[model samples]
Target chain A: MNGPIIDITDLSKFYGKARGIEHINLEIGEGEIFGFIGPNGAGKSTTIRILMNMIFPTGGSARIMGMDVIRDTKKIKTQVGYIPSDASAYSSMDVHEFLSYCIRFYQIQNGEQRISDLSELFELDLNRQIADLSLGNRKKVSIVQSLLHNPKLLILDEPTTGLDPLMQSVFFDLLRSENKNGMTIFFSSHILSEVQMLCKRVAIIKEGKIIQLEDIDNMRKKQLKKVSVELADHVNIKSFSIHGIENVITGPGNMLSFMYSGNINDLVGFLSGKEIINLMIEEPSLDEIFLHYYRS
Target chain B: MNKNLFLKEIRRNSVSLMIWMIVITLLIVVTMSFYRTFLENQSKIVGMLSLIPKGALQFKGISNFNDLMSVLGFYAANNVIYMMVLGSIFSIVLSSNILLKEEYDKTAEYLLTRPVTRSEIFISKLAVLSINVFILNLVTALAGFICMELVMKTPFSIGAFLILSIYTLLLNILFGAIGLFLSTLIKRAKPITTFSIGLVLIFYFIYTLSKITEGAAKMGYLSPFRFASVDATNPAYTIDLWHLAYFIGISLFLTGLSYRLYKRKDIYT
Candidate 1:
């Protein structure tokens, strides 16, 4: 409540000789939609599991809600909800039974009403057996269960896996509304566009380490910009030299594009004499920004 | 312990426990039903049994033909396989899977993320396992008692019958402890049901082999089944304190060790 809602310091986890995550340090403040992006086996789940106290970290520590993750797991979990990547529920239980079981773990009034509201929003049938539901329907059940207790902080790992586009829209809208009501969300996913769409700040992890941490606005406006140009005549582009110009590519008809990180004034001054035919500079897609980081 | 988890688990295993109870009870009923007919032809059956090897008779736990003259002895000798071996099998299967099922079924994520401590989860499941084993033993033992009551030509020692039932329960509980201990040591999330059953069968074989072979008699000590005395026909039939310590001591030790292991176990699902 005083400092950051989620604080991780020098955390490391190793699976025997293999690395799970190493020397990872991160802090996420209260009431923020923090994105954790990483490819498969990139230790996104490992960090989240340690935060949720599902697995113990081999070194360092993590704290949530200003308490140690391991020592205060039960207390911390009282206000923390999680939606795991896999949508596997107890196949023996129907939708209502599974959700009721989940909500009963927490001491909350109006649990049945909460379940009903969430199920209705997701269009989930409460009587259908989990084993009989499709993967997407199972995801809807998972989402409904996580929200039933009104946890202060929600951690979702690839939560949109089997969701249809319509359902995803509804889910995002719900998340937006929840965040506005003071819930901190740690959204972990490999999809950059989704992270870009929902998160104000993001940490990109690669190969068991954090590669980039930045605000979405600063990452786009304050730094990198995608610039492409066409000239009337082909020229030796190798002759051009400017700072922060990277990943340059050439196309037919003297078309060229590259990421520009230098001052816009300098870029324009350098190109003012050339490229008289056409010029365009715009914010890069999250994919291009990620490519820039990966390459760098 | 978490009461919600305990009740849910009990409900989940109810069907399996009931089926095991019925199967073992049915075996006892059918075996006891043959008691009266066997008594009518005692002399002929005794002569027929004389042709069988002494080792084979001992394997069925019938060291003396006169023991079969009593209904309790007949029931103990014939139903040892169903009550002790099969019951132990059931106990092990249930205990082994009770905790591991959450992982293999991929439901552990939901369970562990709840506002419950690992100890509460472990103890809740342990309570369910203990209660289920106790119920199974109680039902089958009562069935044995009732069958003896129905078929008895003369009243047998109630003390001896009670001792046999306690020994069977102790044996089943010990297997349950072993199952719990082994499950915590598994590194991956997969069903160990086959391996668990095979372990019971192999131990039973070692026990039976040791019973028949004089040289392998000492080897019987290696099997938990050896500590469970099935000699109900002996006039001095009683629960041996040493055997009692063996059952209780190993069970408590394994259960305690499993608790420690599970508390530190890195759950992967």
Candidate 2:
């Protein structure tokens, strides 16, 4: 409460010789929806697993609400909710039974009401067995269980894999309302659009390291740009080589496309002398930005 | 131990427990039902048994032809494999899967993320495992007792019967501990039911092999079954203090080791 809601300092996890996450430091303040974006196997789940104490860190420490994630895991979990990337629940149990079982872990008033409310919001069939539900429905069940406790911190790992667009919108609105009610969230996903839509601040991890950490708006407002040029005469990709240019590729018929993060003036001056049939420069989508980070 | 987890586990395993109880009880009853015919044709059966290889008979725990003269002896020789070996298979299978099922089922995310420590979860499941093993032993022992009472022409030694029952219980519990310890040693989430059952059978094979092979008698020490005295007709048959210590010591050691390993285990799903 006094400092950050979640504080991870130089946290590292290694599965023997294989790298998981290395020297990762992060601080998420209270009431913030913090996004952790990475491609598959980039250590998003590894970091979350360590924070949840489902797996141990090879070195360093992670704390939630100023309590050690390892030593104080039980206490930390009391106030934290987690939605795993995989939406596997007890298939033998119906939706109501599984949700009820989960809610009993926390000491809360009107747990039944909470279950009902959340179930209604997700349009989950209370009588449906988990195995009988579709993938999207199973995801809805996962989301409902995580919120039953009204935890101060909610840690979600790829929380929206199978939800429809409508459900995703409803889920996001619910998350906004919860954030307004003073819950800090750690949302991990490979999807950049969702992160861009919801998170205020984000950390971009690549190859087991945090490559970039910045405010969502600041990240977009940065000098990063998607540039494409069509030349009447064929231009060698070597000529387009400049600092901050990544993922350069030559398209059909004398066309070149790449991400350019260098100064705008320098990019324009470099292109001014070229016989340009057409030139296009615009802000890159978050996916493109993420690709740029990964390429860099 | 968390009461919620313990209760939930108990409820989850109740059906399996009941099925095991029924199967073992049926096994004991059906085996004991043949006692009357065995007694009636004693001389002819002895001649027939003598024609069979001595090592094969010993493998069935028949040390002597006279050991099957008494009803309880007949039960012990015929039913030890079912009650002890099969019961052990049941115990280990239950214990091994009780904790590991959550991992393979991918429900550990819900469990580990709850407001409970790994210690509490492990202890709770251990409690369920112990209770399950105890109930299986109690039910099967009672069924054996009833069958002996109903079928015996001569009364058997109740003391010897009780001692055999306790040995069976101890053996089953030791297997449960072994299963728990095995589950913790696994780095990934996968069902080891087949492997756990194989371990029990392999141990039984070792015990039987040692019994039949004169030169391999010393190898019985390696099998928990060797420590379980099942010869109910032996006048001096009692629960050996050394054997009791071996069962209790090994069980406690494995259980403690399992608990420690699980506490630090990186549970994956």
Candidate 3:
């Protein structure tokens, strides 16, 4: 890798006596949509907070674009756009006023165009007060504010939460465009399908530890498939046993279900030799992969 | 960055500022009007002043209507105490929102992710609070002076009132800094506000107790409110510059402490 956009080394955080996160080490490449997948209370938010420098770590350090998160927070913050898990703005302010206020703070020149672009992209109404906005609309405002400055990096925690499916797709499309423009997008989500659809690579976290980190394509290749077959009459299911077959489920009237890993050539050959009436092959969903990680 | 943040703070606290202005103006007007009515009853007013403690009577210098207006000016100066306390409360609540509100509103993650240092953010907020305190004291003093002129119809020393106003502004800044310090230490707003009010009351009570007891009079130095002494006619009414220095020193110290704590503190939900 040329240089990771984000380099976290053994970053740990503690809430009083309770462990928030521990020994978390990761490096995210530039222009990569790295999905941080973890369930609630799995330390995803804690890690994001540390990276943002909104909270100090109990031990270790995090860096963005090679700058220390603590010592160089101001420089780091200018380059990054963040959408928190729970998106909220000042309730007393109207959407336009709030965005304008943030724009002033960021000191962005020609900020009007940026505001217009974001408001249009996110389908946000700038005239409405923040208190009057629904959770989903408020989330849209958060998204607009993050992207308005055209940051080089976007750290979004559960960015799609509270968004309707249509708006979620819109947000995904926006992220895709930003990624294409070479913005490093790092986000966490418990919604595996969203990760599967949007991320080229993912790190699965469980109990505050990274359980797996792999390319989505590589993960798909490693997936196991279940093949079920029904024969014309009762038969010995053991006769169909083949190499690379993990297990087999046999039922009355020659019904057989085989769980196969790796390539299924041998099992397919055996099935072709048998008098199979009907057959079905099922690929495990993302939910199963998540459940498998938790169970293990 | 400082200018932008200061303007934003002004905008945020505009409502409280307006409320303070209206309430303070009306209070000055009503008090001045009542003093005018009491001045018409000169014998009765003098009789009441005679009943006060000899020290307070001598300090007020009330022998005529002009002196009576000066006495009322001394009492009106007490409004500065109320303004300082209220302004400090507002500044603390507002400045605290600059950081803690980000956490409460779940915006800290977004804000910190921006290219800005915690120090810069903190300094900007402190500047805003200072400017707010200055404006508040200026407005209160001007309104009080206008009300006094309208009611008393007498020429007063602008220099004396201006000096008193500067002292009042400094006192407001001191309290404002204290409020900012408490905000950084406490997470929630309700508890912080309640605690701050209680602390101010305790300080005031302590100062009052010191006033009533000769041996314990030294304890008044501990109160932030004790530094304001507008009755400059009596030599004893002259404020100790060392005490003023201590007040400013403590305010600056608290502000520094708040900045240090906020910079390193881990924000949690």
Candidate 4:
């Protein structure tokens, strides 16, 4: 309540000789949509699992709302909502039964009303058996269950995996509304675009370590771009070297490609004298950004 | 223990408990039904039984032919396999899966994420295991009682019958503890059903082998079944203090150890 809503310090987890997350530290403020992005096996889920206390960290500490994640797990969980990466629930239980069971874990009044409201929003049939539901429907049931208690903090791990694009829109809208109501969100995913679309601040993880932590605006305004030009005449590759030019490479024929993180006008002015036959400038993929960070 | 988790686990295990109860009760009833035929041809049956090896008779837990003549002895010898071995199997299987199933089924993420501690989860599932084992034993013991009453030519000692039933219950509970301990030690989430059931059978086999082989009689001490006295016809038969301590002590030790291990276990799903 006083400092960050979630604070992780020098946290590390190891499974025998394999690394889970190593000496990682993070802080998420209240009422903020925080994104944790990483590729598969990059320890995104490992960090989240430690925060949720689903697994113990081999070292370091984590706290939620100023309480220890391990020692005060029950107290912390009362106000924390989590949607796991997997949409697996008890297959033997019907959707309504599973939702009801989950709601009883808290002392919330009007539990049925909340379940119905969330289920309706997700277009979930409460009576359908979980085993009978498609993967998408099961994910819907999972989403509805996480929101039934109206938690103060919501932690999602690849929460939109099986949902259709339309459903994903609804889910994101609901998340935005929840955040507006002062609920903090920790959204973890491999999809950078989705993280870009929702998160205010983000931490990019790779090889079990945090590689970058920055405001989403700063990340976007860093001025990284993919530029490719096919010259009408063969030009010296050395001439393409400008202030922001990086990873410059020559292709078949007279094509020159590189990444630019400098002023746009400077790149245009430099390329003007080259007699370019074709030019393409687009946003770099997340992988390229990640590679750049790793290389640098 | 959390009430919500306790109630849900009870509901989840009710069907399996009912099926086990029915199967054991039916086995007891069918076995007890043969009592009248055995009584009618007592001499011929005794002579035929005499021709069987002494070791084989001891394996069936028949110390003497006269023990078989008594209805309670007949039931105890025959039904130990059902109520002790099978019931222990059921108890171990139920206990082993109650917590681990949440992991293997991938529902632990949902359950463990709730406002409940790992201790509460372990205690809740243990409560369900204890209650289920109790209910199964009570139901089948009652069925055994009824079958014995219907077939008994003479009144048997009530105290001896009760002691026998307690032994069976203790044996079942010990297996339940073993299962819980085994489950906690598993680093990965997978059903130990076959391994749990096999442990019970292997213990029973040890008990049987110990009974028949003179040189191996001491080996039965390694099995929990050896501590459970099934001789229902002994006039002084009562619950043994050491056996009671063995069952209660080992169960509590295992259950406590499991709770500690589970509290710190890195549940992976």
Rank by DockQ, descending?
4, 2, 1, 3
Q: Candidate 4 chain B: worst 10 consecutive residues by lDDT?
A: B53-62
lDDT, residue B211, candidate 3 = 66
lDDT of model 2 at residue B65? 93
Q: How accurate is candidate 1 locally (lDDT)?
A: 0.91
RMSD of 4: 1.9
Which ranges in model 3 have alpha carbons more than 4 Å from their true place? A105-110, A222-291, A294-296, B46-81, B84-98, B153-159, B187-191, B213-219
lDDT of 3 by residue, B8-89 (tens): 7668877777787678767766666676566578787667766766534332232333345563454433455565566556
How would you encode candidate 2's per-residue C-alpha lDDT over A101-163 as one tens digit per residue? 898888999999999999999999999999999999999999999999999999999999999
Which parts of model 2 are misplaced by more than 4 Å? A223-248, A260-291, A294-296, B59-61
For candidate 2, the docking band is high
- Colliding residue pairs in candidate 4: none
Please give the clash total of every predicted structure, in order.
0, 0, 8, 0
Against the native complex, each candidate's DockQ, computed on alpha carbons, is: 0.76, 0.84, 0.51, 0.86
The predicted structure with the larger DockQ, 2 or 4, is 4
Off by over 4 Å in 4: A226-235, A251-257, A263-286
TM-score of chain A of 2: 0.87
In order, the first chain's TM-score in every candidate is: 0.86, 0.87, 0.82, 0.94
Better by lDDT, candidate 3 or 1: 1
Interface alpha-carbon RMSD, every candidate: 0.6, 0.6, 1.8, 0.5
Worst 10 residues of 1 chain B by lDDT: B52-61
Candidate 1, A29: how far from true, in Å? 0.8
What would the per-residue lDDT of candidate 1 be over residues B1-269, giving only the tens digit for each residue?
99889889999999999999999999999989999999999999999999987976876668799989898889888996569899999999998999889988989899999999999999999999999999999999999999999999989998988899999999999999999999999989899999989999999999888987989989989999888877888887789999999999999999999999989888888
Q: Give lDDT: candidate 4, residue A290.
A: 89
